[model samples]
Target: MSGQAVLGVEKARFLYGANRVFDSVSLQLDAARTALVGENGAGKSTLLKCLLGELELDEGQIIKSRGLKIGYVPQDVPPGLGDKTVREVLESALPHTDGGEDWKVDVLLDEIGVSYETAQQTFGSLSGGWQRLMLIAAAAKLAQPDLLILDEPTNHLDLSNINTLEGWLADDDRLPMLIVSHDREFLERTTTRTIFLRSDGAHSFGVPFSRAREQLLHRDAADAVRRQLEGKEIERLEKVAARYRVWGVKNDAFHKRAKATEKRIDRIETERTESYVARERRLELHDGEIDAKVALRVQGHTVTIPDGSRKLFTIDRLNVAAGDRIAILGVNGAGKSMLLNALARAYDPDQEHYDGQAAVRFNPQARLVYFDQKMAELPLRTSLLDYLVAVDGATTKDANALLAKAGFPYHRIKGPIADLS
Candidate 1:
């Protein structure tokens, strides 16, 4: 296969109202796998939309061969019709005819660990993780698109399912792919290149995420040193100028030398000062010994839906001790949320069973603030101060400080949180 399956972007520009999301951003995307990464609001999604022709560029051009088949797996699945089943969704992608190749769908479902009986069940009843898995299988199996774009494909998958997806991506002959994922390991394992979008625009590097991270860190360090040197030079110029002003009043010879030194200092200081690059805030939780006083423990926990007589999930054993900051690992329907609820006794216990010693003062996952992938659930209607009051108690000064740290402006604090998005 030729690398030119996907061509380069020549000075592309994308604008939303007055805000220019991409300004003369250029990149070359070949047939090799690539990863797109950026912080929230960096326009990563917008760029993908523009590439797919869903959004037209305000300036420049994206040239590609006609009839370029592209498959896009969105971060969130749209609500499906209740009448559709898991198998139906997959089969729908195939051309309807008697004696057609239905085996492709079957093979994919099996490979992705979806059972035949489960396939027959209604899609609406399936867990979110399972739906994500089915969608991935469908995209991979049905279209075999020349280019596959997956956004957060591993969001709901458990470790096992994630590994399965990783293996699929790793297959040497797999089609060219652009994955938008937060899973550092997944990007490292699958992509040969990375496209990072910043507030200013987008840039591409021919390296994996881990290597790219190292390069970025090294560049930042170099930039910091340059800035420090520039600052020192500026200080030196200020001191020389002060000495010149003081000495010029008394002695002619000394004044002339001081003036010459000041001129030289000014010329040196004329060089541009490098801008300081802001670093991403990384949250690091302290790791402490797990206390014997268990907050939650489950053994042989399983969830079975009444429809299709299929076993939805089966967990052998799970445990959570005090001060354990454990992340639940599973795909959408893998029953992670359900297990959490069951462990917390939020819902009926009959849905799942557990046998183990458990004690907990609080549900860390539930209580310790949540930043959902979709920011829609956040308290958008309330004022920043009001929202903080609800979460951390009513302290206006403390709320203002925390909101500022989170990037909320003083002027915007009083505005509805909905306006922030």
Candidate 2:
């Protein structure tokens, strides 16, 4: 990887009203693929938007190489492209190029081992993972960008798709990239540089994610120690100055000494080491115990496609007890989704009221909470505080407290959820 800085931000500062997202953030991306990492709502997305020219910075500038062309793959598949064939979607990226460039789509699919049938299929007809992969292929191969930016590319992917993405990235080593992801293993395998975005600024390291994170945390610890020592020194100085003041009431020399001591204390205060105080944020799960030992049971259930024209798989018997962890594994296009979807569909809150036997049965005392991978249930326009307040038994004060604990600034609580990174 080249050491030359290809893209960078210098002293960048951005804010939402009085809420500061990041201040004095600066970093450079060279030929080495870089990972942009931070806590949720840490302004990583906002910073990327600033770099992509979608959002303007309040201070500083984004520097790029002359004629730099960037290809960006967002977290979600772009709207209105679901009706377009995979080949057509790739061709759309080359609108300004000559007609001869259409051949790149075929070459890209072949390079990634995609079949002709997949190329002819509509973008929306494919799984979420495939849809995202197609967009990436189009941006990288068809657009011919100088740099590629991928945001959470593995959000809805299965293990097979994730491996495919990793392989593609490994093969495309010539292209510089700025990837924003939370997948530690993916970053460790794909990126050579790591950048940590914080409320005060950004920290950059040449090492991969794990090593870079270790170095950053170490530096924070050292700063904390230094601050503690500085505090003790200041305390000692203050005490000496106080004693000198008491003696100076009777002597001019002591009065001069007291003034010098006070000056020393002021200098230490001015140059004292400052450590970062992280926001009170936590990621936790509801720890409620089920009243029944056996939470669910399944027997003779045949999982099928949405239209029920074809059967994917069948379960002779399956049991899930309370406090049990389960994992369903399969390749892409297999019956993993079919099985999960079938189970989710069978779960009804009123199942306890019905006495009829069924293929799937749940204990009456067991409660179910399903998390959709697509995050379709999240309301885009509602503010974080308002969303929490809407929850049963959650008061406005409680919501605000929870938001604070989740590292959201008080000023940003009223901002729409869509604005979150």
Clashes of 1: 13
- For each candidate in turn, the TM-score is 0.72, 0.90
Q: Residues 71-145, candidate 2, lDDT per residue (tens digit)? A: 899988889998988888888898475678777777888986779987898887776767887788778767878
lDDT of each residue in 154-179, candidate 1, tens digit only: 87777777788777777744588888
In model 2, the clashing pairs are: none
Ten-residue region with minimum lDDT total, candidate 1: 358-367
Choose the strongest candidate by lDDT.
Answer: 2
Quote the lDDT for 83 in model 2: 93
